[model samples]
Target: MSKEIKEKELIIIGGGPAGLTAAIYATRAKLNMLLLEDQILGGQVRNSYTIENYPGFKKVSGSELADLMQQQAEELGAEIDEFDMVERVDFSGDVKIVETNNYIYKTDTVIISTGATPRKLPIPNEEKFSGKGIHYCAVCDGAMYDGKIIGVVGGGNSALEEALFLTKFASKVYMIRRYDYFKGEKATIEEVMNHPKIEVLFNKDLVNVEGNNFMEKAIIKDSIDGTEEEMPMDAVFGFIGTEPKTDHFKGQIDLTDGKYIKTDESMRTNVKGVFAAGDVREKEFRQITTAVADGTIAALQAEKVIVERKKNQK
Candidate 1:
């Protein structure tokens, strides 16, 4: 059974850096705000091992940073509800409505910061060995493969960073990429190329994954030579890319071909009173700093929308 409908001045749909930042700003602006997170409060950041880019902290664990953000938001009077999965959203009326598993939320403004999720490699036995052996987060599973061999896929910054991190535990790491050249920053690329524990394999695609109870090996195809080889490894870490969690907003908001929400510079979506931020929105850059900036802009804009709406009613 569904719970009673609750009303608020603002509701943030995610609990990551973006949503938490939004909550902090919204509460400081004196807006009645509620944050909903279905899973862990940290979102994807929790899967991260270390974050050195976020200013103010020389080096902080992703989980620690997330906990700090949540703490600050709560201390500042932001109401956060974890494990509340949103069932649906309605933006047809003047007040945006969000229906979750337990409650229906009616809000003057809504900020969609439900960030992107890891894009899985569409290989045979991939889903079967998700937790068994095929892991997406190196931080969460890297220790399990101590003194073992593992394959790290993708040529992006995240993939490179995670592979480097895995080297601390894994005996040897195979860094695989579908492209000939690394797409990450020059410095990171150089580090990965020079790392003694890492072997860089370019123009390779993961075609199949095989395992018994857990992942044992993966099949890779050489795009350049059309040759196939079996890479023996304990586990494979896929960091190919990510897809935005915007399926719930279909027909409710404008989106790009990649399914990212379309928003203006103010982070306002096409739908009035609705805004998008973080990795969920279409933008060139996707980083913790960018997500925080998006949240701040969205919350301040949402404050404006709420104040204007109240004035209209008066």
Candidate 2:
């Protein structure tokens, strides 16, 4: 029911900006490499609308950027296998083994670039109404609610950013924060507070999402007084936070705070020949540019390891 595939010099898990960037660098280094992705090559970027901060592109669609990165990796001789979900990984041996649904791959070095997922709101009918009228990324689904009323949950930078972006489409935006104060950057808070289209509802928490087929209203409760209020809206967006997707690497590599994989300055994990990049790694800023930088550094370090090994063989 399974087959063993030939080993490669390097294998990159995940197909997002980090994984793709690593593949490009490894291919240029003449390291026979393969890239594995569970779904498409774009990763979370595909769920975004526009990316203006990635430098070299003033304004570009997220999907377009992902496609371009994929094309570049392919042109550089990186073999990409989409829809390949890795079941397990073995990094104890000299050759790392990556087991997927279709086949097993061996590699001299492995780079884990698996990213994080958005945190969900705990409320009734939340899962049932997902995509019906509720969303996680405002940039991705805000345009659909144009000229309508929408609610945004959380009080962080992402929440405020989403609220600001929603103003471009929604006639009115309601930001619900559980506490009296926000945890976002002061600048973002000031911008949101000054925005005419945005209204902040402090000391409130979402209790339920009400609708039959699409989101029609949200039930909010005052954290202090426990008073409930129903707000009618076309859609609800949540930007609470994100959790790393590092459960698979448990006990296999060192991690920080049981979330991000711990890596040295060179991006090498505690395990030799094993590296991590992107949001999965412990870093100060988790952004597209930083992810790309991590990938490049990991690939270059892997190349160095390969060169040293070849020399030892002689």
Candidate 3:
């Protein structure tokens, strides 16, 4: 005998803030919703040590905030399943089908909130030293390297911001940029440039990383003359950027030039009954507030679409 395919009114493809917020709305709206999370429910935010900008809470750890959201959604009757990797999704038919490693679900509407992941360099020893010495998420690892010298790669706003943040713990921070100029906002660039603990290295490329059991050095090549130099570093952080988690949905939905899901202001995708929110959507700003707003809009719109479809059937 085969396992029964579960049917739901709405299926959320992630369990981050956006997906959790959607669950809160969907369940309150009396929609039978199911949220699928491949890993921990907090997504990338789980790694963040402290978040100060989110309203209501002055400051809170990412894990704590996520737990609260998950608890609220569950109390409101949202069905959340974790560690279920979605292997395939089919939105071509009237009823969207999501196939996971364990089960298949037929859902009336699908909301994609699968967020992005950090993009790392393709250096020769980059992978080898990932956890051993190289690191990402300064919040998670900064405290471990107190008073140690660190190297930060990239010249964007995120890189600069993280470099500054690391200064609170690390004794020295080397800001490595491939171009001669910084690309971040003027204010941020100025602040980082004027910071006493940050040493800016322009026109440099991270060619290789080396360490015995842990990272101790990084090899950099000058972009202008290609002269190579080794920098003594305790740990290296990559704040380059992030890549959207839409590889599984490729060719199934329209995407923007950046490969993020193309959604309208209402969070509706080109395909009917399909919606996207959070960092996965192609939008100007991607923050916790924006992600929450996107989730609210997508859930309300999904409810409206379901009602309209029912009326048409009648």
Cα lDDT, all candidates: 0.91, 0.88, 0.89
Clashes of each: 0, 0, 0
TM-score of each: 0.97, 0.89, 0.90
Instruction: Give per-residue CA lDDT, model 1, range 23-126, as digits (tens).
Output: 99999999988999988887788877888788999889999999999899999999989898999999989988999988999999999999999999788788
lDDT of 3 by residue, 1-314 (tens): 46469988899999989999999999999998899999999777777666767899998888899899999999999999999899999999989999998888998899999999988876888888887768878878888889999999998867877888899998999998999998777977998999999999999988888889888898999999999999899888997878899988888999977899998899999899999999999988877889899999999999998888789889
Identify the superior model by lDDT, candidate 1 or candidate 2: 1
Q: After superposition, how far is residue 314 of candidate 1 from its true place, in Å?
A: 1.5
Model 2 regions more than 4 Å off? 180-191, 224-226
lDDT of 2 by residue, 68-157 (tens): 999999988889898978998888888888899889998889999998888888887888999977899876688899899999999887
After the best TM-score superposition of candidate 2, give how far the Cα of residue 271 lies from its true spot, in angstroms.
1.0
Best by TM-score: 1
TM-score, ranked from best to worst: 1, 3, 2
User: In candidate 3, what residue range of length 10 has the lowest lDDT sum?
Assistant: 44-53
